[model samples]
Target: MENLGVGKVLLVEDDERLAALIAHFLTQHGFEVRAVHRGDVALAAFLEFKPRVVVLDLMLPGQSGLHVCREIRAISDIPIVILTAKEDDLDHILGLESGADDYVIKPIKPPVLLARLRALQRRQVPQDSVRGALEFGRLVIDRSCREVRLGAQVIDLTTMEFELLWLLASAAGTLLSRDDILNRMRGIAFDGLNRSVDVYISKLRGKLNDNPREPVCIKTIWGKGYLFNPFAWEV
Candidate 1:
């Protein structure tokens, strides 16, 4: 696999040896990696590093990675990949619920983690000089900065959430199949059982203030996937 000039990475892992190894491996793969061992200082390091993405360990001394993830999500839309020891569904669900873009369970393989990171990077929608932004009534999505504004309010979205929203909104009224979305966002084919796409969509709807019970902005079409109702955004 080719490296697409991947940007800065902030890695938060308590294991010194493992952190050093990951840092070395990622550095060799053309990523500027900053390793921090504590979860409490993770936000501070993140602010200082200004990393394009984050690799956070689930277990840390000062604070849990889930807490750190929530704190990070409160401020930025940067991609976050969580690292955990357990292979349980609780960990996976909690990681995603905590606002992580992806997760890697331990007994970690450098190449696999690298590939996952690369896949996340590929999801970023390039800023188009001509298009600039997308306007849908009261909602405005600025492609240049990946900022979403609903009238006077700024909607905070995680990197994955924004990517999914942008993809759906870009298509506007058209129905984008789950397979198509998964492939575009993660660079992986849908495996039928993976519900990450749905998870992201649910998060997106919540952030957009669309009622989960009957979402007007982003509608589910039963077997067909989702459709963005551009007209519903009008105040």
Candidate 2:
């Protein structure tokens, strides 16, 4: 097992036994783990603990996990991983749509969860290959600060949204297929049925104020891929 080094993690789980087990396992792997047993208090814990990553469960008391996820996303772009026993596609979609960066179907294997957490940590490090900031007319994406601004107004993007936008903007005007996006962002190949990429694209479009029906910023080249129009932000 590769030591992931010390990092703070917030675990939101209603099940006491599961939370304790997970917290213990992660602590053993050098993580400072804080466990919260209710969804309503999850945000408070998150604010106080300032965890680098959040492991959230859907079936939570006091509030739904999706609600907590959205609350956290509104204020921070910190990585969130949904750990739930629900295996349905709808549950997965809802989790991702609510701002989670990763989803793990549970009957928890500590090693697998640890691996996912490690991956999230790796993603936080700035990419040395990409430029520090990308400016397109009124839109600016600052990789150094992980900030995006449209004109004078700062845009609030979830972690996944920002990453997806950065990926597209970096390869402006080029068509990146769904398979390409899935592999690049999630480390998984598109199975023809997976819609995670589309979900994030929709989210990016909404935040960027691009009309989905006739988007100018992120254009859909049907049956092929997506293209980022670098010249469309002038308005």
Candidate 3:
């Protein structure tokens, strides 16, 4: 983020007042915010702004927020928090199932929104950067070399694949959405499908002999996303 404490937010709400107020409050807290009223415009802003997160309203014009959410999930992994009207439970779960990392109801209080944003941010930073090595069974990730070793065999990986492995292994217990991986690692402008991530992750698992069913290391969070078992790193 260009700014420090406040993370960047791409706000997509038709209500001009709410968008401005939210942006102002978040900006005061050192967050970089960009407001877009239309879903299409919001998509454009998201790519250009490279926001760490996004605030989307389900009732957006030009394009429905649900559609936007699906489209965004197709490319980047930036965390997204959907804003929906009360009683819009269907849309809410759909948003999550569609790939949103979180959601907030309408009539949002600025303070609450800020708090939620912070909590999500806190979850992403690693708790043990100095650990040096991540060992999941016979598979080892040596941070110093930025390499993964399965027993005596070293598995070669692309830059993105290595990063994806690192991010998941480091998080351990946390669930990582595809959007979060793509956005943070590759930037929001990344143009690819979740399948790209799936393919890379699948390849890594195969090389490591990570069971696709009842995986011992990285596990798919079904309905939501993927999570790495830090306990899997216990040597």
Top candidate when judged by TM-score against the true structure: 2
What does candidate 3's lDDT look like per residue over 1-235, in tens digits? 1322337788999999999999999999988998999987877887788877888998888998988987876776556788888545555557765666666777898888887687666544442443478877677887666568877888765434566788888787888887887666544422333354666667667666679777867888776678887666445
Mind giving the per-residue lDDT tens digits that candidate 1 earns over 137-164? Answer: 8999987877899999998877788778
- State candidate 2's TM-score: 0.88
Return whichever of 1 and 2 wins on lDDT: 2
Model 2 scores worst on lDDT over the 10 consecutive residues at 1-10
Please identify model 2 stretches exceeding 4 Å from their true place. 1-6, 126-131
What's the candidate order when arranged by decreasing lDDT?
2, 1, 3
Better of 1 and 3 by lDDT: 1
Candidate 3: global Cα-lDDT? 0.73
lDDT against the true structure, each candidate:
0.86, 0.88, 0.73
Q: Estimate the TM-score for candidate 3.
A: 0.57
Q: What CA RMSD would you report for each candidate?
A: 4.0, 4.0, 9.7
lDDT of 2 by residue, 1-235 (tens): 1122248999999999999999999999999999999999999988888888899999999999999999998888788999879777778889889999888888999988998888777777754544589999999999877789999999988777888999999999899999999888877789886777888899899988999999988999999989999999976
State every prediction's TM-score relative to the real structure: 0.86, 0.88, 0.57
Off by over 4 Å in 1: 1-6, 123-130
Which candidate has the highest lDDT of all?
A: 2
